[model samples]
Target: MLHPDLKAQPSRRLPEHGLAEAVALAAALPDLDVVGQDVVRVAKAVPATLFGSGKVEELAAALRAAEVDLVLVDGPVTPVQQRNLEKQWGVKLLDRTGLILEIFADRARTREGVLQVELAALSYQRTRLVRAWTHLERQRGGLGFVGGPGETQIEADRRAIDEQVVRLRRQLDKVVRTRELHRSARRKVPFPIVALVGYTNAGKSSLFNRLTGADVFAKDMLFATLDPTMRAVELPTGFRVILSDTVGFISELPTQLVAAFRATLEEVLEADLILHVRDIAHSETAEQAADVDDILTRLGVDKSVPMLEVWNKIDLLDPAARKSVEDRGAASEGIFPVSVWNEDGLTPLIEAITRHLDEERQHEDLVIPFADGRARAWLHEEGVVEQERVEEDGVHLAVSWTARQKGRFADI
Candidate 1:
């Protein structure tokens, strides 16, 4: 794998860290061996090969010496550049987007996840037909670009891809509608959703397992869990909430993927509380947090939604650093430091979550007219009614309900 460190471009991570991440990404897939990796510095990216000729030749020699089968570039590589680089290096090549797509394709287990991965991969493949089909000037019939063999075949392939895209979209829409039905059912149940989101390999799955006791696939690997998993947990306050473990976010997540997985991430948008988990032990924790925040903003997460920062992996910290984190967490309002491995600091974190979720509820007095038996029954069914009285004109009641519940009541 090669991570290009162009002198002109600003980066959130050091090139070596990026390369390390790239290696981890490669390791996510089974049967792929990373023979060698490097942080290749480039004064300016070459339009044709993405590296200077000397650098390219030097790396080509190294790859050849190692008998490498594939070259993974941890950056964007244009179709032309990809073709040129593959020819010069005599190896199969994949750019960062392609590598991530491969991992997603491997990890997706649910039907919806599979369809989303296919849709994203197809979208990416559609843009790179140039490298795939090189016979651009073969003439079959008519005139100009339309009738040429290369254009004719490319057009035919694109049309086929377009048809497949439409079919995948239709299937995905059905899956999305099913998911919406489930969300609607959950909404009626009145359980607040608390979603866990963070950078990949940030121990989100581990924390989720610790909290919910569900046997989700938690591993020390990037993109360990792709499909969202939800489980109900009763807090220390006896308050029930649906805890969601979502796909981990990463830096420079492919745009195609962001669009394709929007439905999968709608759980985050609907969440009553978001736990921004961080691997406090990681060197780039701040940059990783920024990346997660940026993705959340792009996903249109509401600023009004409550969020808590979870500084996880305190067990990995030195004694003094861990103490500092504990002290800071004590002094802060919405931040908690915890070690999921040993289950330290969880009681306080759970209490904080309960407090925040409980704060969403408010007391209100309501009068249901005699004609509105349905609304009255809904309030009772919701178990929010604290007291009730039957008056001459209506049923008067005191209820403790969430804003979401109140909105639903208004609809009724």
Candidate 2:
């Protein structure tokens, strides 16, 4: 792995740390074994190879010494640079975007997720058509009858890609429409949605499993969970809610993914509550938090939706540091410190979610006709019917429900 620290484009993370992240990203792929890594300091990127010739030579020797089969570049590499680097290093080359695409392709399990990853991968590959097909230089003479010139290999490949992209988009649109219908259906179920979101590998999935009794793939790896998972969970106050576990955010997330996976992230937009889980023990926890917040802003999550910061993985911290974190959380309004592994401080987190949901509750009296048994049953099913009395005109009911439940009841 090579993390090129270009002078013009500075990163929020240290060069060494960035290289470490790239290694971790490579490790996420099961088929690849990471043998060597480095941070290459560059005054400016070489247009052809990204690294200077001397740096390239040095890396080539290192690669040979390490017996590395592939070189992962932790930054964007133009098509020209990618081709040149692979030739000079005599190894397969993958840039950050390509590495991420591979990981997404491996992790996506659902139909929608698989489609999204394919679309994003095609989009990324579309730009590198020159490097993808070596026959771009070959030309074919046109037959006199049909066209002026026969299509080149590059043109044919690009046309094929364009057609595939169109087909995938059409399929993805249908899938997204179906998902929206599902969302509409969930809206009528009278359960508030609480979504868990945070930086990748921040234990969002672990916490989700602990809270919802779900067996979602949870591991200490980046992007352990890709497709969103939802489960019904009851808060301490007897308030039942739908908890959604979504793909985690990361610093410098690929633009292709952000656009392609927007459909999956709609759950976060519709959430009644957002839980921003964090790995409090990580060295760059604050920076990771900022990255997550930035992505949320980019996603246009409603500012009105209540968010609670979960300081997870306290088990990794020392006792004094853990106490400090707990005290800080207590002093704050929307922060909670907990360790999902230890099952510590989860009750308060649940209570906080219940409080946020209950804050929108309103009490109202409604008159229902004797024949409207469905509406009455809905109110009872939602556990919001506080009192009811039968009258000559109709049945009088007093109910306490959140605004969302009231809207659903209104529909009934």
Q: Pick the lDDT winner.
A: 1
Q: Say which candidate scores most in TM-score.
A: 2
TM-score of each: 0.86, 0.88
| Alpha-carbon RMSD, candidate 1 | 5.2
Candidate 2 residue spans exceeding 4 A from truth = 131-133, 141-150, 359-412
Lowest lDDT 10-residue stretch of candidate 1: 137-146
Q: Distance (Å) between predicted and true CA of 405, model 2?
A: 5.4
Q: In order, what lDDT does every prediction score?
A: 0.91, 0.89
Q: How many residue pairs clash in each candidate?
A: 1, 0
lDDT of 1 by residue, 228-298 (tens): 99999977544579999999999999999999999999999999999999999999999999999999999
lDDT of 2 by residue, 1-412 (tens): 8889999898777888788888999999998988777788999988988988898898899999998888899999998898888888889999999999999999999999999999999999888987554778776656654223866767766777989999999999999899888888876675789999999999999999999898999999999999999999876544689999999888888899999999899989989999999999998899899999999998999999989999999999999999999999989989999999999999899888888886467889999999989988878877888899999989999988877777767776
Clashing pairs in 2: none
